[model samples]
Target chain A: MFRGIVFAFLGGACITLQGVANSRISHDIGTWQAATVTQLTGFIMALMIYLFVRDGDLGGFRKVKPLYLAGGAFGSVIIFSEVTAIQTIGVTFTISALLIAQLLVTFLIDRFGWFGTTKSKMGAPQFIGLAMMIGGVLIMKL
Target chain B: MLIGLLLAAFAGMMVALQTIFNNRTDVHMGSWATTTWVLFMGFVASLACSLIFEGSRTFNLQQMQPWYWFSGLIGVGVVICLVLGIKILGPTFSVSVTLTAQLGFALLFDSLGWLGLEKVAFDWKQLAGVVVIVAGIYVFKFGGKKKSAEAVQSASAAN
Candidate 1:
């Protein structure tokens, strides 16, 4: 539990960094260019590390099903779309949209057991919590 | 502003789904391996998009600022931290905490003008929202039935 809390904080910090970086990048470069370039750089870095350590077992790239591959594609699109939106809508709004979207996706995926994972049933509290989060997000922007 | 918020939310939710997928399938490959594959995929996808959308635009790495590079590094760090954090903290809590922290940092940066954001005053409503959010987080974390019930029983016994 202690460790979990630490992880939570650290994760939060990292994400904050991402937000700051994204904001800065958006100001500097075209939203698409910035996002794509950053992702590419990160990808190259990750790939390099893998090459050095994994002894050339790039099989994970090949092992997954086509739909799994689609996850990556979808992720890119979502990221680019959000970044573009941030330029027009403002940061708070963007973040709020993201939070609500996350809650909904998580709820559905959990409840439906999509993508070969076990389903997560949502209680009333969870639903209420999701709504509260969405409301808060909107309120923050407003 | 509202539209931007919605877009950001949509993007975040998409990320969440990806995370769920990662949790399910990532065990087959360790974090290092999984990160590599995802980054590669993202790279490929982004590159393709860039080509299709912005044809003939030379990507002159030399012309880019240091922030761009730092941004990517930060992204890598975030990915690692998020993966590790999700393992320790459940998804909902992890995401909430992360976003809260992001907001906290964002405010500081905004105030300091560190990230090129102009100085903006934090109004009463923003403060109230922050406080309310903190309270909500506390409730979500400690107000669970088991913990609350245990506390109530212990207090009753003492009384």
Candidate 2:
């Protein structure tokens, strides 16, 4: 549990770092080019790790649902929207708004068991937690 | 204006959905392979989109600084960390913690003017916001501990 929190923190830091790097690259190149380049580099790095680990079978890829394979496509949309939103609304607002939106969708997803996820009903505490987080984000932007 | 905000919200939804998909894929393929597939597929999708929308103008590779290339490498860290996090922390907890970290680091980055971003002076409001967010996470974690634990157990049992 402690380790999970630490990993989650690190993951968040990586996202911020990636966002900065992406913005810099996008300024020099076009947004799409930057995204494509970033994806390519990430692919190469992951491929290298895969080669070293040699854990999962190539055959497993064929067994998974096609919808699962569309994550990358959604990633593309995320990049495009994130970059554009930041430019339009500033980083603080964009991040805050994104968080709120994310929590809302995540709540619905969990409640409904959408997208192969298990249904977990949200109680008052969950809602309060989400609201507090969103409030924090808004305050931070102010 | 509102449309842009709506788009941003949609993008956030996409992010949540993407994580779900990636997590599911990770169960089958392992983290490294899953990351590889995601990046490769994203690269293909972005490339096609770039070609269609930007056309020949999209290829400006020579103008970019060498350091800019590190974004992709950092992306590897993001994928691996997220997969590990979700596996352990579950999606909501992982994502909430991640957002807190992202906001904190983003504020720091802005203050330092790192990575081509213009410097923004640090404000107490932001600090307060960070505190509130951390508090919220604490509440979320402890308040719903039993429920989340049960959910996690059930999820693993399902698998």
Candidate 3:
């Protein structure tokens, strides 16, 4: 848990900013169009960095599964669904549902060691801690 | 409303799965390359959807700020850090911490009204929520591990 805490926090902050930015962009053009622009710009930026770094073994590509290579497609649906949900159910409910679902999926993934992740054993303390976190999220909405 | 909630939840699931899957790709492709590949895939998907559903509306860039168009660059930072964190801490713990950090930013954003997001009045309830979440993480990290942690450390040392 402690490992890569900085990276984790930074990732979260960046997501928030990106969400706000996406919303603003969508307002200007259109939702899916905004998504297209986002992905395009993101790809370009990442490609630039990759070329500059000149790292990672090309041979290791064989080690990665084909299905995982398409992971980025999820972003399109994520953008589309989340925006529609917010419009239909409102921001508060959308945010709450999003957080809960995310936590639930991640928790299940950890407990089952799904998709090749390390299995995490949960005891009473872990459960209690998780409950508290959920409570905190709900409270934030309230 | 139920459908809306379901859609929201499904989006959440995608968010989680996307990170995990992207991390797996990162293991082989390296950080920047993995990010590039993921974004490229996303671009293809979004473009397809745009053409099919969004169609004519998709191309109308009618005099919007060019700066806002660059927002996607921020995704570069988000993906790289998330993959790095997941590599070290595993998905669940890493994501939980990420959520906490996000809320912290939310608080800051709300207080300052940054990026034109509505300025939410600072309230004790929101403050308490932050406190509780932090406490939860503290418990998850170090609670009930005093003697057992020491014992494990010693056991490992002896091995």
Fnat values, candidates in order: 0.42, 0.70, 0.72
TM-score of 2: 0.86
- The DockQ-based order of candidates, best leading, equals 2, 3, 1
Candidate 1 Cα deviation (angstroms), residue B52: 1.9
Interface RMSD, model 3, angstroms: 6.0
List residue ranges in candidate 1 displaced over 4 A.
A1-4, A51-57, B58-63, B86-96, B110-113, B133-159
Off by over 4 Å in 3: A1-9, A57-62, A84-97, B1-8, B80-97, B111-113, B141-159
Tens digits of per-residue lDDT for model 1 on A1-142?
A: 5676566666566665566566667566555566677777777777776677773345654666666545555546766766666456544445545655765675576566676655444456655555566556546656
- Error of model 3, residue B116, in angstroms: 3.9
DockQ of each: 0.37, 0.59, 0.52
- Per-residue lDDT tens digits for candidate 2, residues B1-159, read 555567668877877677677667767886677778888888898899899999998785789787666678888777667667878987667766777887788778777878767677878897787777667765665565344432322111000
For all candidates in order, the CA lDDT equals 0.57, 0.72, 0.68
lDDT of 3 by residue, A20-80 (tens): 5665567667778888988898788878878888777545668899887777788898987
Query: Positional deviation of B154 in candidate 2, in angstroms?
Result: 15
Candidate 2: residue pairs that collide = none
Off by over 4 Å in 2: A1-7, A140-142, B1-7, B83-97, B145-159
Give the interface RMSD of candidate 1. Answer: 6.6
